[model samples]
Target: MNIDNRIKFRHLLCFLEIARQGSLARAAEALAISQPAVSKTLKELEEILATRLFERSKQGVTPTSAGLAFLRYAGPSVQALRAGVHSLRSGEHEAGVARLGVLSTVESSLLPDVVRRLHDQHAALVVSVVTGPSAYLLGQLRVGALDLVVGRMTDSPQIEGLTFEHLYSESMILVVRPGHALLQVDLRDRSRLGDYPVVLPLAGTTIRRYADSLFVQCGIALPQQRLETLSVALSRRYVQSSDAVWIAPQDAVRQDLARGELVELDIGLREPGGSVGICSNPTTPPSLATQWCCEALRTAAADYRAALYP
Candidate 1:
């Protein structure tokens, strides 16, 4: 079938916002219009498509089967058009934008390197980064909210429709302050870890599973005094000030280890890491800035792998 010339950009905008916000009133607020206008615009869109795009209720709205099918194309269409408009309006100076979703997995080291390399190569590229969990980041990526997500989210169910490229594997290590008592003990003797306070990733995060498993591998239980958090900076600071043991992704504390500020303890695991990489929605065509970002990511990954392994 041919396109419906009757469907204007306003219809697409309204539909996308309603789906994103899940309520006509919220969509109206987002678009700076009245709720009635949002309803009228949505009704017009449903009429143009000759199908019910959303199932409405007091609880809010959810995309119908037809709406979901339409969204696959509509989301990317709007994102691409926006990027094109940005590039055109900025003349030849701007390289458009690359919106990124980041997890704690790369926030400390790898992400910084990629951004530096991206700006060094494409000075005028507009880059935005959002940091969060795998599930949230992947959800945003599946929509048009993010161009790509970079981290150890390969195992997340949300990674289903997106594409992931393995950069390298990063291991989890036990870390302590420079003069912590654990440093004096052998790996076998260190199994009595329950004696001290511990810092852990918050439950439900991808890395927390690894942190828990490290305890299982050592036949230890988390101490009664345990601090759980998503912030790497918080975990690092807390561990540095006290005797609390920390389960940290190697990359998160790589510089500290190198600088002798923190020490890594061997838990005797043969393999200690998970897949670290980049994930992007295959449906969307990447803009110039996103392409440059991907290229920079790949280059950074190559260097990261060599540095981590060798």
Candidate 2:
């Protein structure tokens, strides 16, 4: 099939946004256009390609097989075009840009410090950070949406195509607000933990597995009154204001522990914890900006490890 020049850039833009937002209205709002206009543009693009792109229903829209295939190419092409435009506008091609995916655990201190150092060294470089769960970040890294991901190394089959560089190790810690009633309870009496509300990562996360294992090792059942989340903000707020005990990564609450806002409970399990590292698709060569960002992260991780000893 010959290409149709009748399909404009706006058609691709509209199609990609619909795929991303999963609804015409949301995509219209993002593009600052009317819903009917978006619909028309999508119809035009579909006519040009002679294939349906999305399946519409009450739950919004989902890409069909054809849409998904197109998306794999469209997303990266759009991003590259935007990056080129940005470089031209800013006249900073040498500095370039690094798209990074970060996990919630590293947001405490490591990511911020690494970003600061990257900026200090490369003043014109643009660093974009996306923070989310490890699995989600890894998917984005593989799809070219992100240059690299910094977080716990996942052991799932999804990791087969990626390469991981060890940055540091972090373990789950049971934390509570200062002077919580659990502090007075005997450490060996694991049943006491059930009496209080518990905040834990949602099931299937790397940290949640460690947390659940800790309870099993103590021969205690998980608490019935439970709140599952991966958001550090929600977990911290709930744990501080209430008697809820939060099981989280030590690095996530490192500042809270240092400032006396939260205390770590001694569960007596010497679990080695999970490996925190940089994951990247092995097939894709790193850009200059990405290379710099990786180096900066390694330096920051080394500093963090050194501080653990000294």
Candidate 3:
């Protein structure tokens, strides 16, 4: 069909706004144009398509059959354009920017290796890392502000349009400062480990959930007189300064453990661990920078697994 290319883009924008807002006044309000302007654009769009795209009535405008069909193609194109803008604005001419959110545990335990490996592979890649509780990062990811989130999947909120790929499972363990009394017993034995004061991660965190589950399975209720905090450093310090055992990821305190600064408490229960993953909105076509970051993270995960367990 012979069609003017200029009107197609304009018509698409105007029609999309009307379709989105469902009312001429609202669409005009949203577009910062007049109601007449909106009506004119819709008319032009209908003229180009040679069909009525909306059914006007007292109830407001609704998409016609033709409009419904066209939206399937148009919606994704618009979204892709937005994604492209994010990629370009972040300097697409350069390799790419990987905006990632890593969970605190992974940030401490697994991220260094992943980041180092990622950088080694993509020297030109600009890595922008944001750290936070899992829920906040997921929110950013949902709104298209972040490229990827590396965090515990258990505590993850429902983020529409996102895909999650499981990276690895990590055992939650009770850790304390060096020469803690709990380490003297079998960590798998719940009764012995429950005797000491506890330093716990916040109750609802993924790590804490696993830690709590293990305690429950061992038929031990954690001590009521316990200290709770979100900061891994603070939790570690609490354990170090006093006769307290803190439940956390072994990797989060790996350096302290290796340096004889902390010891894994013998909590006599076999506790299941939690899973970590990379999350992104799968509906949007990922930018080259995002792909680079994903690859880097995967490589980091691989190298970390080899170093930690191999």
Best by TM-score: 1
User: Which of candidates 1 and 3 reaches a greater lDDT?
Assistant: 1
Ranking by TM-score: 1, 2, 3
Better of 2 and 3 by lDDT: 2
Which residue pairs in candidate 2 collide?
none
Model 2 lDDT per residue over 1-310, tens place? 7767897889888888787677999999999999999999999989888999999999899888788667666656666677668768755676678999888888777898999999889888888989877776766665567888888856644465578999888878899999998888777877787788899888888878888887787787888999999889899999999999898888889889999999988867644579999888765667789899899999999999998767
Segments of candidate 2 deviating more than 4 angstroms: 1-7, 43-52, 90-99, 130-148, 153-166, 202-206, 216-221, 270-273, 279-287, 305-310
How much is the lDDT of residue 252 in candidate 1?
90
Once fitted onto the true fold, the runs of candidate 3 whose alpha carbons sit more than 4 angstroms away are 1-92, 155-161, 185-189
lDDT, candidate 1, 19-98, per-residue tens: 87878999999999999999999999999999999998999998888987787778788887877666567475355578
Query: For residues 187-258, could you state the per-residue lDDT of candidate 3 as single tens digits?
Result: 555677667788776766666788788678878899877887767777877788998877777668877878
lDDT of 3: 0.73
TM-score of 2: 0.77
Question: What does the lDDT come to for candidate 2?
Answer: 0.83
Model 1 worst lDDT window (10 residues): 87-96
